[model samples]
Target: MEASKIRLTVPEGIDPSRVLGAGDGVLRALENLVRAHVVARGDSVAVSGDPDEVELVARFFEHAFREADAGRTLSADDVSRCLAVLRDGEHDASSLRDDVLLSYRGRVIRPKTLGQKRYVDAIRSSTITFGLGPAGTGKTYLAMALAVAALKRHEVGRLILTRPVVEAGENLGFLPGTLEEKIDPYMRPLYDALFDMMDRERTDELMERGVIEIAPLAYMRGRTLSDAFVVLDEAQNTTPEQMKMFLTRLGFNSKFVITGDLSQRDLVGRRGGLADVEKILGRVDDVAFSHLERADVVRHALVGRIVEAYDAYDDVREQRSRDRKESR
Candidate 1:
């Protein structure tokens, strides 16, 4: 059989090391995965193997070079991710990785999947966005990134992060110290993601000056949120009335992002606000909804499988219930 070969030339400004990786480990991974005899030197790479494998190796470097050309460094995992995305052939690897929502320190936050890209785009174009998805799909995290980005760009006057502090009915004031202390635990996740993007000193400064507000959903009642980017996280625990009040609080020059897992709602004997608003505002002007699926889970790879498993179980349970009711 004749040998099939392909040579890739790394762009001028992009270092070959960035595309081919600096370590022998990742270099070997590329060879093993692509099943090609890879010899990388200077600005050029040579892949000689089966025609199919040679093409795979060529595509891998093509994406890696593009990522490097865009000034985004690719780690080994990123290289692997790029290869997988290219192999899937459903999405453009550069497009998914290039629209950076925020960059902090050395970390670049952006959509990892096609669904996430659509969700972020909806958030950008709509006045109100509902991100309904399973856990670990980057719904809340992306919203936070965009909210911080907007605040940095002076597109909004402030940022508001809130969630329902469910205690049967969110009347948690009966538990402990001031309302701040009472709700502090429930607010920890918001604070954690916020501080990740900004230094603790600066985050505290914003909190102290009221430039960034982190409060319970109950606290947001009867207030006008103007010129702000408001994120309501874990909104599935909110009641219909609470959702109404929260949406009505939107003032001029403001954007609202509500994120929740509808299947995980904990609103005892009451309909979840995220689910309720979906039916009402789905067709309303300037309001949008993005439904993310298991494929969008950006946590561990196992998380996507786990979400699929639970979704399957839920379907079976619902079907069984319907069967039993029909037999009566």
Candidate 2:
């Protein structure tokens, strides 16, 4: 079979150098576009192979960067919509627009930040989604939002939230009270997200009704979850075996959102479950993995900066430790 070609028309009045950069620039852009089956660059950018892919890419460039020289600032929403068009193979823009506009529980769930939108879409389409990144990047919050949205739309019967209860090297056995009580602190972030989406009284009511269930990662073993939206928060603390077990527990009619900050793993000397999942299933079809970087963070402005700072700090520490070990 012959490889199809795509001709991309660079708009006039816009500096190709600036837009495409020098050497390898145009190739990189075309590579991204082609991933969506849009176009392949040659003497001139042309769309071949799939007719729908060609038109979609053409429309995306036209709508997104057509007026670049006019000093038009592309908002985050614009970027999100364009990406959604590419990610979803559907030719109809109306459905993408409608999904983007759809509100959950009177709160407009539009993907204002690029990562948030990607995470939401992944959660909706894939049976399993891995949201990995630093803190304050909406990794857990966005997953909770999607889970809540699914529950509200009756796509799932209940919401199950779980996380490893490892904190400050404290063993779960040493903690006072029952299993739930011991794990509540570690799972507080998940609870906080629920409270934000649902009213305090209503959230409590649901908890009492068992419509919303929170548990430690240990309790997730030996069970099959069906007709539920399960979220594993702070998954970076889970060992590789635990992560595998949790993922395989998904029964029929169930979806999972696993969120974690790799740098914050509490399990010393043990690999993070979330990281292991990404490594093992990155290329698996029907599984979506979205990464939230520091830029996509929309919390307090300082939060984004803080995440970046910690990332830099960790990088430096790792490098120094490696150097010292080599020297020894």
Candidate 3:
């Protein structure tokens, strides 16, 4: 079959170079990926390729330009996300607009990819949501945004952010000044996310008043968390007992978002509680498990490729193990 060709017209309001990226990097990626020849000619994109590939290129432009039109500056990461959404078979980019989860101080927090959108939606509708994915997929950040948004809306009385401090799991007294001081390094990410969404004064006030409590997961035992939005970050380091204790702490009118990168689990001798709970809660009601992939990574463009390489390496190792097992 002969390769088809199409000339994509670019509107005057949008710059072709912006969509194409600096040095035509995105263009080169498209050409190499779809095996299509892409070129930017005076306010339009000229491409020759297979019919489906041509259509895909068109959809990518549609998604990218839609985001660009929605007041977001275009980037190579945006281009990659657009292509990811197209590959995921979701064509509409309109929902990516006007859907500000939270807006404060000119910083708008919203899902940048379809996978993130699903994860965010799951957080909204579920009692317990597990955002299991690689790093930089916005799992923890988006969960934090939702928690803050819910707090602002008065849907929850308070917000509780906690993470498993694997380094000082139960031996915090041996470390330093105070309990808070000892775990400060491990819990800084959660505090950083809170400060990003809220002002330091308000956050500090809430902490002083105990409305917004940032504590290590070990402190959660024997407590019923009620009327709050609770987040368990870095849950993959949790043991089964700790996970049960954490889940059982869910009190009335509370929501939980457990975000972790299972691949980065730090448990050396025991299975990660997140891995266990996923299998146990696969069929439970009001529970959601959203998985993000390498393509869902929204950090540096190389991050997604790095995730892909690691995934491929893991696949090879697993296959080799299976082959050895068969021989034995």
TM-score per candidate: 0.79, 0.67, 0.87
Better of 1 and 2 by lDDT: 1
List model 2 lDDT by residue over 1-328, tens digit each: 4544556666666654433335534335554644344433432355565555555666656553443554543443344445455556553332333233233256644454555666777888899998888787777777777777778788888899998878787877899999768777887887777877787887888889988898888888999999999999888888889989999999999998888888786788876777667667989997889988786776777987888887899899999999999999
Candidate 3 overall lDDT versus native:
0.83
Instruction: List the candidate 1 regions with Cα displacement exceeding 4 Å.
Output: 1-61, 68-91, 99-104, 168-174
Model 1 weakest 10-residue run by lDDT: 97-106
Model 3 per-residue lDDT tens digits across residues 130-179: 99999889999999989988988899998999999886355666776877
Model 2 / residue 226 / CA error / Å:
0.5
The segments of candidate 3 whose C-alpha lies over 4 angstroms from its true place after superposition are: 12-14, 67-71, 98-105, 168-173
Clashes of each: 0, 8, 0
List the candidates ranked by TM-score, beginning with the highest: 3, 1, 2
Model 2 misplaced stretches (Cα beyond 4 Å): 1-107, 169-176, 321-328
Query: Which residue pairs in candidate 3 have backbone atoms (N, alpha carbon, C) closer than 3 angstroms, thus clashing?
Result: none
